[model samples]
Target chain A: MNDKITTPQTIVLIITTLIGVWITTLPATLAEKSGPDSWLMVIIGGGISVLGAAIVTSTGRQFPEKTFIEYSVETLGVFGHLFNLGLIIYLVILTGMVVRIFGEVIKVFLLDRTPIEVIILTMLALCVYLTRHGIEPIARTAEVLLPILMLPVIIIYLMIILFNGDLSNFMPFLRLDFKEIIAGTKATVVSFLGFEVLLLFIPLMQNPHQSTYSSFVAILMVSILYLFVVVTVIAVLGIVETSLLIWPGISVLRMTETAGTVFPRMDVVILSLWSIAGFTTISPMLFASAFGISRILKAREFKSFIVPLVPVAYMIAMFPKDVLEARKAVEAVSNMGLFYIFVVPLLILTAHWIRRRVLNR
Target chain B: MKGKVFILTVLIGASIFFHGCWNMMDLEKKTFIMMMGIDALPEGQQDKIKVTLTMPVPRQLVGAEGGGGPRPETPQQILQSTGNTVYGTIRQITNRLSRQLYFEHMTAIVIGEEAAKGGLDRFLDVFQRNKDFLRMAKLYICEGKAEDVLKMETEMEPLVVTYINQIVHFNSSRSLRAINYSIGKVITELHETNGNSLVMRIRPEKKEAVVAGSAVIKNWKLVGWLSDRETRGILWMLKEINRISVETSIELQTPQKGLVVLDLVNFTNKTKAKIQDGMPVFYINMRGEARIVEKEERIIKKEENLERYEKPIEQAITKEINNALQKVQDEYRVDVVNFGEHLRKYHPDYWETVKEKWDLMFPHVKVVLNVDVKIRRQGIFK
Candidate 1:
């Protein structure tokens, strides 16, 4: 019953989590703000995210054997319990938003007549099953599924670039307005929010010292993939058309025509693969929240908490009235995630530093 | 054992919910529309549009096995409906059909001249928004009503849409006159240029359809048309021309006149823009290699220089390009030559200042042309 995961598994988990439903809309979101300079915004956003991940990982490495809840309780005394609850709340809401968006996309593209509630509930059931096994099984599932899901997507992107890409669509390059690019950078950074899961998983890493390196490598890999996706989508569809579509990534796949091949269209194939990607993304967050609840209740096993939280997550997923409102809710949660990713880690590091200095005195 | 039974019950219950068969319609019950045509309603009609959907009958398309009898003349069903919006008309047609109308397999979309002139953004919005619509569908502007082009019978292929698609695919690659403008490409171009772009034109005849030239779209409305020769000239400037043959008559030193057909084997151009006195001036350098494909008379002597033949060919190309440039710039007042795009890519600062009034300034911009044509081969005959 050893629960430790290898560094490679952690890296895979990070990559799959960072690339949820957002990758499908990142190009359009970035393009809407920065026009043709969206690629530059992605690079800037990735650089900032790498910095944020470094701080969170360094904080987690300080208490290598304890989870984030344990370390927070030890650091802030009474407030630590409240902070742990906040973190769990954030993770629960995030999982709900992710599942809701996934259902929305599946309904629009694949199953036009399926009710959104059915889609949400089924996805939650699968995630609950995965989360009940704890982090080790979730990491194992991600390790086995990342390559199967990503390789085809990367190949299709490269094919589109080779056959249909127009380099001139990236014109008016490097001519970004300062204000617009700053706004675009903020939006792009929100997409990189999932990498903060390292704060919870770092304790489970067999080699805690390499946690920094693993997180860095994972964020870099995701950044490169994001860069490729954004560039290819913009190059083929152009900035104006890309910014107009709700799901520009899927639209790009739909427009791609692979002549003389067995499968002329690839949107269906890519979407089926993306459903797996969505599973990997939400399961980790679900596990984090359930594990946090068990730790707070002083229970030995997190499995019992998983089922009860499913209804909570389902309720939150159904809270949004429509797609537009769901998007707004996701953005609100992402902004809160920014606080936990940046401010909470900085608070812990400063408090730990001050405590050590006083002990030395 | 009790725990195991409970887990098995939950798993079996989950399986029922996960199948997601609610949206599934049997393949036999779905009718696939191969082509869609949009036209303006006839004058004094209540609805704004007339939509035609062409669905292929699979049984007739496959033909009878071992039965040596005449097949149905038209193996496709054409249904028409009228409504105010594109989606409404489609739904109106769906009301009468026995099976669900599917548009995923659509090959082409033809818009009549009246519809295109009224502005295409309204008609194109549904195609852009709906996921079932094919973005790769080829878009063409019919010379008259789109229904005429959709209903025209073709002896070459059983389906008229496939025939039109093949004609577009063949002519776009082999000739410079026809451009292969897919829905995706046209939408991107229209968005990039703010609704100023070009669309391939299709003209319906008595029994067949002709796909050639292009319709000039300005501000989302069809403003004018470009002839085949003019389209070729614009293609040359836009660097979209491929495998085009040029025919020119040249005078020889032997006091004989001959008609020379030269195949422009390799052609490339470089366009440079510079701002002078608040106006942009373009410098175009055109270089190509030509091989004589046909000759009416023997005009080349053993000792004659090949450069003599290259001069007339270059002049003819320059004149053709100028004619197209003049028509687009002066008559149409459209900048289909991509000078605005070129300036935006190379000189962003200069473009930002003039992009607002580019249409006004495009007609006055001076163009300097440099042509270098090399006659590489004089054919097998001396």
Candidate 2:
């Protein structure tokens, strides 16, 4: 929590977390609603995200070296623990949710015969293993996968677009009509949901200078990438086909074929590569949850404990009826996640102001 | 050392458990697809769509005398299956294969004129629905039997479908007969309002695939085909006219430059639809650079050439553009290029009132085409 020195670079925190959190699933899910205009919605959601990031970053600077949970105490007093406890619980829930959704998708598409519990446990195990390695391991993993993941994504996007897509599908341009377009932004906004995690890591930053700018840039890239996916899925799959499917982005992966060639169903490779994204997303949540418990309980070997705790996440995942129920369960928690993203910042700022006024007296 | 050990373990583990084909086919077993042709069987005879899948035999399989009929080592194979529906025929074909039939390699899809006219929408759905199918596969409306185009041999390339796919895509890219469509587009048009689609037409050459014509689709099914010239007109209204040719003639002062083909550059084509006293008028503005590609007579000086060629090229392109507008508006009676859609989005409330009449209003709608084509760059020859 000593933020007075040894801060993480703006680019490192921003790109590291951005690359880590942006697993393929979010955009893939959003494709159902936004269709060809999903990317535009990504930009729209991204813009809203920057404002959220700014509010969070500004509040963090006021507290000097303390992280968000620590500042929640200075702000809300007795309520600070309540805030911390809720967020930590939510984070654990989030880790399980990511693991569950990813496991189900892989189960249905690639490993239909594999038991869902086994799939969830295996993925959860990987997340726990990485959490034990700490933030630096996650960051290094992102660094390694960044070029490997992004270069191909960019190359594939350009190649698919060049092949031939019905521009007309995009044409009933902004075709959702205005009311639907605005409504579409809600879920699309959720996919770009990770910058809220920045509140936890601000103190760890080597140099928090221009952190907002780095975060915004990352959001912009996500928006553009999401938009590209939206456009491709819509232009290639059309609106109806896009909406009928649950994982629209995965469908896009299935379509990476060059006409008159032997290669077909390239999505399998994309899913394989995306395994890293999925892992990174879940690791942060588990690590933060473990870190929060350690802080609360004063436990040693906290990271090691999280790995064994994968069974707990696996158990929680089974509570949901199925994929549909699981998504609904996560969405219900979104109100709480939003509180963490927005409300906590304002609460911290209020606490700081009150603490300053009381101390001056 | 621990990290190294883990890395090695995972690498070996992935190889053992996930190294290959979690969701796809290996090369040996796949029935590779090139061209899929669908035609309706006549009435009660509607039991077969002369399905043809063209494949290439590698050089290794060529001219082997020791091989008995259709040797196992043959580089390529063309398999045909006849069934009632496109999906049905594909299934029948897959039954004959050792592995799944791969549609990712499909280059062009041909619907015989009859198939399209008799409702080919059902056939298109299977391709659209299949996750394994390539949306980028070029679509065509064939003039005669679709099997003819599929079965044709290639004079230049080994595979007929590859040659044709290139021809259609390349020319479409070049801004020639504007009908390059993916299956993704087909699905979209079938769903939305004022929704329509276009497909390229392919035919059999001595041994290669030829760009034959284009087809216009209405309500998910192909309605009619358009001439190559007409398809070019369709492109102008749609994608930006980047590098299309416009023919013109300039009466040279020093020497007569007769009919010349001008190459368009730095072009911008904008379409606007507005309610003028409660009537929708489409105003098209085109501004671009034009250069003389070929001329009956040549003037050496660049300045003189620019001065003489400017006015006629502008006039000719205006005429060319107006020609496209007339046909797209009147003959087709459908906004395939989405000009009306452009206006509707930017002006929603206004469109809501008059949207119903767009089809009725479009045919007679007055089109004002303005072209200000400037000559910025000419070839090295000029």
DockQ of each: 0.71, 0.22
Q: After best superposition, candidate 1 residue B342: deviation in angstroms? A: 2.5
- Compared with the true structure, model 1 gives a TM-score of 0.93
TM-score of each: 0.93, 0.76
Q: How many residue pairs clash in each candidate at the backbone level? A: 0, 15
lDDT of 2 by residue, B246-277 (tens): 33223222236356666665666777876688
Q: What ranges in model 1 sit over 4 Å off?
A: A257-263, A359-361, B1-23, B65-72, B239-256, B299-305, B378-382
Which 10 consecutive residues of model 1 chain A have the lowest summed lDDT?
Answer: A256-265
What are the per-residue Cα lDDT tens digits for candidate 1 across A1-361? Answer: 4888888888888998998998998999898999888999999999989989999999999999887788887877777888888888999999999999999999999877789999999999999988887788999999899999889989888888777777777877787778998888878889888877777777778988888888899889999999999999998888788998888998998786543134578888789987998999999988888888888888999899999998999999999999889888988998888888899888888877877797552
Compared with the true structure, what per-residue lDDT tens digits does model 1 show for residues B1-382? 9999999999999988877565578998999999999999777873499999999877767766654347554678899998999999999998898998889999799999998988999998888889888889999999999999888887788899989999987776666577777888788788878888889999999678889899999989999999987887787777454223333222222224767677775677778888899888989888878776666665446764667777777788888889988989999998888898888888899888889999899998888888888888877877
Error of 2 at A249 (Å): 5.6
